[model samples]
Target chain A: MKHAVSHIIPNLTTLTASQTLFDMVPLFREIYAFRDLLWILVGKNIKIRYKRSALGFLWTFLNPVFMIIIYSIFLKILLSFDARDPLFLQRLVTGILVWQFLAMCVGDSLHAVLGNASLVKKTSFPRIILPLSTVLANFVNFAITLPILVVFLFVNGTTLGDMWLLPLVIASQFALCLGVSLILSCMNVFFRDTEHLMSAVMLAWFFLSPIIYPFSKIPEAFQRLALLNPMCGIVTAYRTAFLGTDLMAPRLVVISLLMSWLILALGVSLFQRWQVNFGDKL
Target chain B: MTTPAPIIDVRNVSKRFSLQQQRGETTIKAIVVDALRGHGKRRDFWALRDVNVAVQQGETVGIIGSNGAGKSTLLSLISQTSQPTSGTITTRGKVSSLLELGAGFHPDLTGRENVFLYGAIMGLSHRQMAERFDQIVAFAELAEWIDEPVKHYSSGMYVRLAFSVAVEVDPDILIIDEVLAVGDASFQRKCIARIDAFKQAGKTLLVVSHDLNTVHTISDQLILMEKGQIIATGDPDAVVAQYQWLSRETACTAETKEWGTGAVKIKAARFLDAEGQEAEELQRGMPVRIEIGYEASRRIDAPVFGFSIQTTSGILVYGNNTQIEEFDLPFIEGKGTITLDFSALELLAGAYLFSFSVHSQDHQTNYHRLDNGHPITVRSERRYEGVCHMPVRWSVGKGK
Candidate 1:
C-alpha cells in the first residue's frame, strides 16, 4: 500500500532533521540572509511611532527638553542649587537625552515579540530581528534628537571636546541596548510577567546610572561600585563630550566597552537558544 | 529512461507539543509551584506522527480533511514555519507560503509600503520589489488605492494585495492553505487562472482546502488524512470517495430508520453495480441498481413504490415513484424484492442519501417509509459545478 502511494507522489527535494541547539553558525547565516527584512521592520516601527501624532517627530526633541526643564525647576526650588549655571544645565540635559535613548529602547524591546505575535506565527524569519528593530528604531530617534544637544552646547558657550569620541560612545551604547533588548524580548515571549518586571527594573536602573547627578558626587569609597554600572561610564562620557571635561577616564571607557560586548555575546546566545520555542509557545 | 527527482521529500516526520496545564504562568509563585510539581502538570500532544510525502516538479497536490486532522500542522512543517519533533524534510529551491492573508501587513502603512515590506519578509531584495511594484498593484486591481493605507482597504482588497505579492515572489515551490477561498467569485476565477499559469510554468504547488470541488479540479493527486495519518492517497476521485465513506460511516451509522404501520416494512436496501455485486461506491455516468427487500404482513392492492435520492446536505437531487410513472403493482405480501435501475447516473461527485417508501395507489397514505436509507457515494473524473450534471455541450461559431 505504501509503495503504491509513494509511486503516485514525486521527489524533488530532500531534507534531514536533527536537533541543533546553541548552533551559532546557522543562526548567523539565517539572520544575514534576512537583513533586508530587518531594515524594513525597523522602518515600520519608526514610521508607526510618529505617524499619527500632530507633533510627529517633534516629540523626540520635546521629550528630553521638557524633562530637563521639569527636573531643573524642581531641583532649583528644593535643593537651593545653582540651576542657573550653564555648565550644570548643559550636563543635565545631555545626560537625560542619552538616558532616554537607552530606556526607550529597552522598554520597547520587552514587547517586541509579543506585539508581533501574528507575524511570528504566520511567517518564519530570524526572530532576533523583532527585538533588534526595536533598538534600531529608538536609535533613529536618538539620532534625530542629537541636534538638540548640539544647540544646547552652543547656547551654553561650551565646546565639544574630543568630538571623534562621540561615535565610539554611541556605538557602545547601541550595543549595550541591543544586548539587553534581545534578552528581555525573548524572556517576555515566554513570561507575560516580564513586562511588569521590566518597568521596576528600569526605575532602579535609572537611579543607579547617575543620570541626574554628576559622577563626582559619589564618595571616593563608592566610586568603584558606581563604576560597575555600565551606564555610569556612558552618561559620564556624554557629559565629557558636551562640557569638554576630563571626567570620563580611560579605564572607565574600557570597562564599559568590555561589559557591553560581554552582554551582547550572552544575549545573542540566549536568543538563539530560546528562538526555537517561540512558534510553539506564542 | 531515467525518472526525474521529486521537488519535495518528507520522511517519517512527527511533531509533539508540550501543553502546560496553566498557560503563561511566569510569576514567581507559579514558577515555584511548577518546580515543586516536578513538571507533572504538563502533557504532550502529538499533532503528527510518522507521516511521509513527496512531490515532483510541476505537480499540484491537494490535501483534504476535516478540522483538527493535522492538515495545517503538516503544511507548517513543509513550509518550515515550524520544525518537526523527528524525521527529516528537505526541499530544493525557495519556498513561499501564504498560510494566512496579510499576515505581515502593518495596518498604518500604505499599501505601497507594505508591498515592499512583505516582499522583504518573503526574501526579495528592495530593487526586485520595486521593479515588480507596478505589476503587483495591477494584478490586485488596486492601482488607484495603492498609496492609501491598507487599513482603509476592504478586507477583500487587502487579501488581493497580499496574495498578489506572495505569488509574484517567484518561488520554486508555493504552499497555500485555504487562502483561495477569499475574494469575490470573479477575483477567485482570476486567481485560479493565475495559479494555472504558475503550474504551467513548472512550479510545484501544495494546497490544503475543505472545498472538494476546488481540490478535484486543481490537484493531480489527492491525500486524505484522518487523526494525523494519511489514510488514502492517489487519484482525486478515489481519495474523495474514501473520504466520503469514512465521514459518513463515522457520523451516521445504522442508516435504516423506518416509521410506518409495519404493514409493508423494508427489510433492507442495497446498491449494486453492473456486475450485480453490492457496491456502495460507483463512478459518475455508471449504471446503478438499488435492490429493496421488503416483507409485507398483509396483501395490498395497487401499491405504489418509489425512491428519493437527496444530497448529503438534504437537497433532493432526484425522485421517482411508480404512480408518477403510471405503473402499479397488483399486490405485495410476504417477503419479496423490487429493483430500480439507472442506465447511467448523472449525479456529481458527492454522497447522497437514498430513501425507499411504499404508498397507496392514490399516493395519499405511506404504508411504510425508510427515511434514513442507504448512503451511496458517486465519484467523478470530470468536474461539475453544481449538484447534478445537466448534459450540455458547447460549440463556437461566428456571430453575425
Candidate 2:
C-alpha cells in the first residue's frame, strides 16, 4: 500500500477562513506587517506638505483660526447676531471645526487613488488602506487643533459640565467623515471627474450642514430636511456638547448614529465591489 | 517524487482581457452606450485560454513560452493577482509569489520596514519576520543600507532586498516570474543558487523564464505554452526539444519569402544521423546528414547545393558547400532532391540552424536558393563550453 504524505505547510488560501470577520485577520495581519510602510506613508505626506511652510504645524492651527475670525466678522458682528446667547460663538466654532475636519478628510482622500496609482498597479495589497491612511493622518491635524478650540472656549469664560461627551461627538464626526471619504475615494477611481465634483459637493455640503448659519434659523420644514442630513445631527451634537446644554437632542444623535452606519455599510460594500477588479482596471 | 495529489490543480483556466485603449470620459461613455447596444467597443485579446496544469508537492516546474504567450498571466492566476475567467484553480500550499521585485515595497520606507511590510502581506507573523530579519538582510547584502530608505537604493539593490525577504519568509510554494533577470549576472547566479537550495529543501516552485539555460539547469519538468494553451508538458528535455522544433519552424515560415525563390522552391529539409535516419537528437562531434527536397520550375545546368550551420543567436558557425568548392551537379527543373553528409557536427549543446542555398557552380546567382534553409536540432551528450564543442578529456592528479 502507498502511504499518503500529510501536508505540513498551510496554504495562504487555507489560512483564510470562511467567516466574514475572519477576513479581518488578514487585514489586521497586513496592518501589522506593513506598519512601517503605513507610518512612512503618513509621515511622508505630512512632511512634504509642511516642509518649507514658514509656520509649520501652526498652519494647522491657523486654518480654523482664520475661519473663526471670518465667521465672527461676517456672521456674528456684521450680521448683528446675538453673541451673548449661551455658547453662541462656541456653537459656531464647533460647526466650523467639524467642517474643517471634513474638508481635510475629503480633500486628501479624493486624490488617494490617483496619487497611489503606481503602487496600485505594481504592488498587491489592500488598496483601501491608502485612502484610510490619509484619513488617519488628517486625524492628527484634527487632534492638534483641539487645544486651540479648548483655549478659545476658556477665554470666552465657558465652563464644562459634560466634557466627556466631546470625545463621543468627535468620534461620531470621524465616523461620518470616514464613511463619506471612503465612498468618494473609490468613486474617483472610475470617474476622473470625481475630484472636481468633490469640490462642488463639499461647497454645497458646507452650506447645507448649518456651518455658516444655525439650524434653528432655518424654517421648520427646512429643519426637518437639515435633520435628515447626518452632518446636521453631528454638528448639533458637537455644539450641544461644547455649549453646555442649549439644544441637546439625543433623538437626532440616535438618528445620526444610524445614518453613519448606513453610510459605512454602503461605502464598504461599494469599495469591495470594485476592489476585485481594481488590479486589472487600475 | 510524485505525490498522491497535486498541491495545485489548475483546470481549464483561461483569462480574456478586454483592454480599452482610451479611458477618457467621452470614450467611457461611448463604450457604455455601445455595451448597452449589445456591442463591445473594446479590443479583446485572449491572454490565456484552456490551460491545464498541476504542480505536486516538492516539484519544480518551469513554464516556457514566447512573449505574449501567457506565461506571466498563468503565474498571476496561480498567485491570485488576477482570477481566471473560465476555470478553477485549487492550490493547497502557502504561495509566495515574487511577481515583481520589491512589489509591495514603499519607496519612502527603510529596507527594514519594507521587509516587515512585505512579510505581513505574505501572511507571515510579525515575530516570524523579526526572527528572519537579520538573515534576510545578510542574504540581500544590505546590512549597512537596511536603515536607509529604499528609494535611495539602486535597482539591483532593490531586487536583492526584495528577493531576500521573499526567500527568507519560509514559504511552502514559491512563484518566481523573471525577477532573476533584473539583477546583475553575479546576483542572478546567487538567486539561482538560492532557488536550487529551495528545491533541495523540498519546496514547490513554479518558474517562468525566457532563459532556456536556467530552465534546463533547474527544472525537473517543463510546460510548453503557445497561444494561451499548453502545447506540450512532460520531461524537461523532451518539452525543450518540442519547444525548439516549434520555434524553428515558426522562424522558418516567418522569413520564408526572403529566403526561397519561386522558380524552384525548397519545400522542406531534414537532418539525419550516420545510420541514414531522420534525426531529432544529435550528439556533439557526431557525423550528421542533410537532405534537401525541391520542386523545380525549369531545368538548370551545373547546379550546386550549399548549406550553412548557424548557432541559435544567428552567428554563422560554419559554411561551405559544393558550390564554394567548385563541385557541381546537373538538375532537372520539375522535381529533385539533394543529400550532403558531414563527417562530424562540431557544435555545442544548443539549437543550431542549417540553411541551404542552390546556385550555379561558376559563382553566378542561381535560379533557386533557400537561405532560411532548414534547422537542425543539436544536443551534446556532454555539456561543453564555447560555441563549438572541442574534444577533450581531463584527469584528476597532482600537478606535474
Candidate 3:
C-alpha cells in the first residue's frame, strides 16, 4: 500500500544533475531580491562600530586626522622634504582617507561570512549580503571622514575643479574594494589563513600605492607596473580632483576600471560556486 | 479550474556530507600536494536519501525520529537553510523557519533594534516591521526589556522575543525544529496555542520534535523516519505505533544479557488486555495488565515483584513494586503469576520499555531481573503535550 501511494505522488520538483554557467545569472537575481537585507546588515555593522565608543561618530573624522599628523610628522618633518608645501599635506590626507577605507573594507570583509556562521546555518537569505554589507559599512565610514578631507584641502588653500569627475573615481574605488572584499570573504570561509594573508597583502599594497609617497617618486621605469595596482589610478584621480595635479593617465584609469569589473565578476562567480556548501562547511 | 499546488513539494530529496578525515588537509600545503597528485580521500555519508513529502496548505505534518535519523536534515532542506545534494524542493510561499531560537540575534543590539534587523533578514521592510514592532513586543511580553540589549535578557526572554518576531511575520509555511522546548511551561503553552491558531488560519506547518506527545497532538499527519528513510507515514497514532515497535525491537536486541542468582526467577513477562489475551500494544487511557510469571527453586520469604515503564531513553515514566504498594507476599516455592492491573494507563502515544524484577525483602539481593523485558506501545485517542496524559477539564468565560 505504501509503495502504491509513493508511486502516485509525482516528482514535481526536479533539480538538475549539474550546474551550468547560466546558473550564475539566476543566483545574482536571487541576491538582488534580498538587497534590503544587505542594507540592514550594513546598518548593523556601522551601528556596532560606535555603539560603546565615547567619541562616537567623531572617531571617524579623528582617525584620518591622527593618521595624517603621524604620517606628515614622520615623512615631512623627520625626512625633511616639502615641509611647507600645502599640496603635500593635501595629497597625504586624501590618499590616507581612501587607503583607510579600502583597508578597513578588506579587513572586515575577510571575516564577513565566517563571522556570521550562526546566521548562515540557521537562516535562509542571500549569502552575498554578508560580504557586501561589510564593504558598504566601510563605505559609510569613508563618507563620514570625507568632511575631514574637505577641511584639510581648505586649510591647504587647494581648490577643486570639475568636481563631477570625483564621483567616478570614488565609484571605481568602491567597485575595486567590493570586488576584492568579495573574493577574500568567500575564500576566508574555506581557508581561514586568507585573513592573515590579506593583512600582509594590504600592507604591501598600501606602501606600493601613492598614499604616503608621491607617484612621481617611483622611477619612471616601474610606473606602468605601479598603475597595474588599481589603487594607484584611483588615488591619482583623487589627487587630480582635489590638489589639481596633472590628470591621471587615460590608459591607467581604464586599466583600473577594467580590473575592478573583472575582479568583481571573478569574486561573484567563485562566491556562488562555493556558497551551496557553506551551510554544511560552517 | 486548475488544482492548487501544495505549499511545499519535496521530491526524492537527499543530502550528503563529505567528512574530512585529515585535519592536515585544511592546510594550504596539504591541499596543494593533494591537488598536484590528483587524488584525495573523500568519505561521504548521506543524511537523507530519496525522502518524499508534500505539505498542502493548512496541513500540520510532524516528523518524529530518534537522534541521527535525519529529521533535522529533512527540516533544513525544507527550510532552505541547506540545499539537498540531489532532487528538488519547491516551496510556493514565504517559508519562515525557527530552526533555532535567537539564531540571527546580535548580542550587542537592543531587542528593539534586533527586531528590525531580524525582520529585515526575514525579508520584511523597515516600515512593515515598525508597524508590527509593538505587536511583536506585546506578544513576547517583553515590553519592559525591549530597549535593553539582548545579551541582558535571560535565555527564556531571548527565545520569547525570537519566537514572537518569527511567528508575527505571518509566513505561509512555518517550519519549526524543537524550538518550543525552551521557555517556561506557560510560555510554551502560549506558543503552542499560537501555532494552533496558525493552523486554524490555514498555514502549512512542518514541525520536527523528539517530544512524541507534542507531535502526536499537533500533527494531523505524522512521518516516522529511521536512518534517512521514511519508514512510515499515515495517521499520527498508527505511525507512532510503528515507531514505538521498531524502537523497542532495537532496544531489546541491544541488551540481551541477563544476570541473576537464581533463588527466585522471573520466568516470563507480557502485557495483557482486560480479556486476558496477550497484547503487545494498548490504547492510551485504557486498562492495562502486566502479568509476570515466576518460579522459585527454594522457598523465599517476602519476595517483592516489581515492574517499571520507561521511555527508550531510560527515563522512568512510572514504576511500582509490590512491597512499596504494601501488598505483602508471604512466601513462594513454585510457579506463580504476579498480576499488575491499572484501571487506566495514562501514558501518551509512544513506545515504552517494561523491566520486570524480583528482589528479597531488604531489596539488596536480586533474585532475578530482566532489563527491557518487554515493550508496550500506547496509542492515544486524544492529542496530548507531555510524557503522560492527565485527566482534566477546561472552562472559558469572561471574569466579571
Model 3 scores a TM of 0.85
> Where does candidate 3 clash, by residue pair?
none
Clashing pairs in 1: A11-B5, A11-B6, A11-B7, A12-B6, A12-B7, A13-B7, A13-B8, A14-B90, A15-B89, A15-B90
Q: How well is each residue in B51-158 modelled by candidate 3, as lDDT tens digits? A: 988878899999988778999988877766677888888886666787755556767788998888777766677787899999999989999999999989998998
The per-prediction tally of clashing pairs is 10, 3, 0
| lDDT, candidates in the order shown | 0.80, 0.72, 0.79
Best by TM-score: 3
Interface RMSD of each: 6.8, 6.0, 7.2
Mark the 10 consecutive residues where model 1 chain B has the least summed lDDT: B247-256
TM-score of chain B of each: 0.76, 0.75, 0.80
Candidate 2 local lDDT, B222-328, one digit each (tens): 99999898999989877876787677656333243334345666666777887878876676788987777877777776676777777665677888877667666
In model 2, the clashing pairs are: A11-B93, A11-B94, B298-B333
Best model per DockQ = 1
Rate residue A153 of model 1 by lDDT: 73
DockQ of each: 0.32, 0.29, 0.27
User: For residues A1-282, what per-residue lDDT tens digits would candidate 2 score against the true structure?
Assistant: 001111222243411112232254665655655555566566656755686689877788788778777876786677666545655667778778878888988888777766765456545456667767787788888888877787778876777546777877777777777778778888877676788877888898888887756777768777666676888777767666666644646775668656866786677667755655555565
